[model samples]
Target: MPIFIDGHNMRGISPTDLEKIVNSPKDNFGITHLEVFYNESEDKLYCVLDAPDEESVWKHHESFGLKCEFITSVKQIKTAKDLKEEKFQILGEFASQLSHDLRNPLSIIKNSVDMMSIKYKDKLNADIFENFAKMDRSVIRMNMLISDVLNYARTQSLILEKYSISEIIQASLEGIKIPDGIKLVIPEHDFSLKCDGTKLQVVFYNLITNAIQSIGENNSGEIHILCMKKDDIIQIDVQNSGPPIPDEVLPKIFEPLFTTKDHGTGLGLPSCKNIIEQHHGIIRVKNNPTTFTILLPKDVEKLSSITV
Candidate 1:
């Protein structure tokens, strides 16, 4: 039986648009089951490809400015589920239970911080106040983990929305406190496309954030963005100057919980993959020893205003 994807209300377009995305090259990877993407306006398509292992998914999608994860079981090929099942798989279940159980202590810490604020109202040193803030950040990180587990355990139930692609990137930059020294190189031309704001934001954010992190503190790099119209489709390329992503590690970057960063959740990039696939867009990441680039081809209605 064909996998009946039920994201009707999720997409901000018509069913016919989705049918077009489904017919794109990426959707017909000829695999028993694979991942594909569509544009919010329903005009473009991209493929994530199917491999015998999860490592390949990471390597393939990463080249497109997207991310992926590693799968250890045959059940992973099924479209209905992915990383979500792993959250409750044997020992994974216990880990989640433990993370959830720790919430009580985090709440207590927050409460204690509140109490200290009151008890030392006027006498609290600036240093002490700063410590409370530190504690707060720690609590937030823990909560983030719990949320990741839950999200991973569930199919994002992809809530696709028709959104302006260009605006999403700008919006992401606006809200994020980008580290200093890294400069964002905006495209010289105006380009617009449609996609889910939340998911697409993740896609741009992860790529941009990764570029900044690659150079570390005090180091500066130029991040360039190129958005253009290729006939009826939209193509986006984000390039950064930094150390090249090692050819060996490139393939496994998308696997869940796999990360080169010590504190990485390994979910940001993977989540990006899911969102792009749903949008009927293609994403690829590449490097030339000193520069890195990501590619995304999205499908959206060719508006007269944008066509010229």
Candidate 2:
């Protein structure tokens, strides 16, 4: 059996003593190799413990000598991008299976409902019909979200292709679900840049969606996009009207796993950064008291180095 051990989170054991416990026989039981995962801050180590059984696990954990919070696994156990990718492949396979399996049944229900409405419109109550229709819509949304998840996973998987900047922005607007009050204004201009078009679109969509989500329900706002060129460089600006992101948060926005929204994955902006860099361009965010602007600069020199 595979057992995970938290080396530092155990209570009632000194560091030296804990070493002795792990080194010697644990509770006079036959224990195989133990897996240890740990992170330390301010001289205290946060740890996660995985063991075979409740009895043996608890007994061994108590021997660590520190009052530790035992958990099955950590939320994110990565120190490098490569390790994260490996874990992503493992988990994403499971999600792909689940999404595929769910879609089959959902499609059947949708088909059945579509057929029934025509045959029995008079008998089916409006509320019941609405519920069925809503279910179909919800399932479709879930399918799209799952596809988004797959695209997200595959994007980080080191794939690259050539794409145009103009098409990407158009696709982004189409893919994004904007709130009623927020409007997106796209400019007409000749702006040409190269990138992984699909992933770049995701970045645009994420940024634009964030703009829409930032406005309060009662507040109205607008997002303006423009493509401009000066000499050899092309600039794409996505500006949104909303409360400015605080100064403190601005610096951290590009950092992976940093988010201002609840239930957000925190990958959107960083992913955008990565996509733009991959395509020989640089993406930046700027904000004023009531507006946020994302700038993408086209430069072969900087773009090549950052992507590598």
Question: Number of the top candidate by TM-score?
Answer: 2
Across 151-267, the per-residue lDDT of candidate 1 in tens digits comes to 444444545456665677786564344557888777776655554566566567667777777867568877787777676566667777788889998888766777888878786
| lDDT computed for candidate 1 | 0.58
Report how far off residue 3 is in candidate 1 (Å).
Answer: 28
User: In terms of TM-score, how similar is model 1 to the real structure?
Assistant: 0.50
Q: Model 1: runs farther than 4 Å from truth? A: 1-154, 289-308
Mind giving the per-residue lDDT tens digits that candidate 2 earns over 52-108?
A: 554665566555444445444334445688787678677667766776678788778
The regions of model 2 sitting more than 4 angstroms off are 1-166, 289-308
